[model samples]
Target: MAQFKPGERVEVSSNDRGFRGSWYAGTVVRREAKNTNRYVVEYDQLYEDGSGEKLLQETLDWIQLRPPPPPPEKKKVQFKFGDEVEAFYSDGWWEGAITGEHSGGKFAVFLQRL
Candidate 1:
């Protein structure tokens, strides 16, 4: 496992009694010492989204930290033209029909433009 860096997103243990379960998510605000595992995390309320208020900001060891999950993988588009697909778009996800395969994960989608 790589050393957690400041601004690195991670999950923090909420188990105050040192129980095996329970975790609260937060970002690594700062490193205590150079090349050390100490961190200061500003914790949020359990299950709180960005809109919710923060609960606690505390110093914890690296053992209490867990890396944030990897981003979701894009599904491979397997099409032979004229295939309907709900393709991801910059504006928003769109349901479009595949018109051509441009190779190497590229495809021409005839999107039903809004």
Candidate 2:
């Protein structure tokens, strides 16, 4: 009965049994106009059965936004030879380990991290 915006996280209400026992945490992927407004959400939660691992395009009305949890404590990681870390690149976040070094010591390219 509430409006959901694209990319907003939402949970499937308990009454929505179609997706009740499966993955519920999802992001609103699209909105549709059926007799009533419907949302096509991309389910992000993993289910025990591997068969249900596809992006679920579920209706919007059945989903409700779950309040975001508090942010986790920030842990600063010192780059080391085999330390796993994520590198911020122009494209996106790349998971890797410290492999090579650069001039200032602050820059290092992760190798075989993912």
Candidate 3:
């Protein structure tokens, strides 16, 4: 029995050793006729040519697919404009200042070190 059904949005593993932790967005098409543990997926952005207009579809093992993550929860706003904050970027925390606030708990920060 497959955990996912047709038309469900999922993230497929890259399966490349160089990018082992990456996943690409795709939609489940159907389970393989001869293999229930495998599925056909249509990738969201992959293209068959350099024109970047066609989507690429491929068969993938169930172990390489996972349901998309849920939307992030909104956090209470704690800092106002001009407040100094530290943001994580490039594998390190960098000093920054909150410059603007956007909808959905997003903030526009200006990092002086960048």
Candidate 4:
């Protein structure tokens, strides 16, 4: 049987009707056991068109789990003079070059180019 946890995103296999290759995206809300080898999953559908629907508690032997993307790498503060660095500004993080530095190694970076 497929193992699914609450709050996990899942893709429901296409319906037996003529539903084509489309799959429904939903969050697993409940699970029930039938007999000794089958599982019934209850899912809440989240649609792109701002509509939601609840499945009638379907049973399945397996479910696919899609992992979330990795987080971005953190920027290090160590930089030498004239080294390119991305500066956080009012607009957003902008690429810039370190123009000067203090005696304690604090850098004064200027936006060399957009």
Per-residue alpha-carbon lDDT of candidate 2 for residues 1-114, written as tens digits (9 for 90 to 100): 577778877655334433332224567776776634677776665444558666546554544445334465698545667776656443223446677667766757643322
Lowest summed lDDT over 10 consecutive residues: which window, candidate 2? 14-23
- Ranking according to TM-score, highest score first: 3, 1, 2, 4
Tell me, by TM-score, which candidate is best: 3
lDDT of model 4 at position 31: 55
Q: Against the hidden reference, what TM-scores do the models get?
A: 0.48, 0.40, 0.63, 0.35
Report the Cα lDDT for candidate 1. Answer: 0.67
Scored by lDDT, the top model is 3
As for candidate 1, its clashing pairs are: none
| Candidate number that wins on lDDT, 1 or 3 | 3
* RMSD (CA, angstroms), candidate 2: 11.9
**For residues 1-114, what per-residue lDDT tens digits would candidate 4 score against the true structure?**
556666666655433444323344455655554543334445444323434453555654454323233455697557778897656543233457899988876778876431
As a whole number from 0 to 100, the lDDT of residue 19 in candidate 1 is 31
- For candidate 4, the TM-score is 0.35
**Model 3: worst 10 consecutive residues (lDDT sum):** 86-95
Per-residue lDDT over 1-114 for candidate 3, one digit per residue giving the tens place of the 0 to 100 score: 447899999988656654444567789999888989999999887767779788889998999888877775797558799998756543233457899999988888876641
TM-score of 2: 0.40
RMSD values, in order shown: 12.8, 11.9, 8.6, 14.1
Candidate lDDT values, in order: 0.67, 0.55, 0.77, 0.52
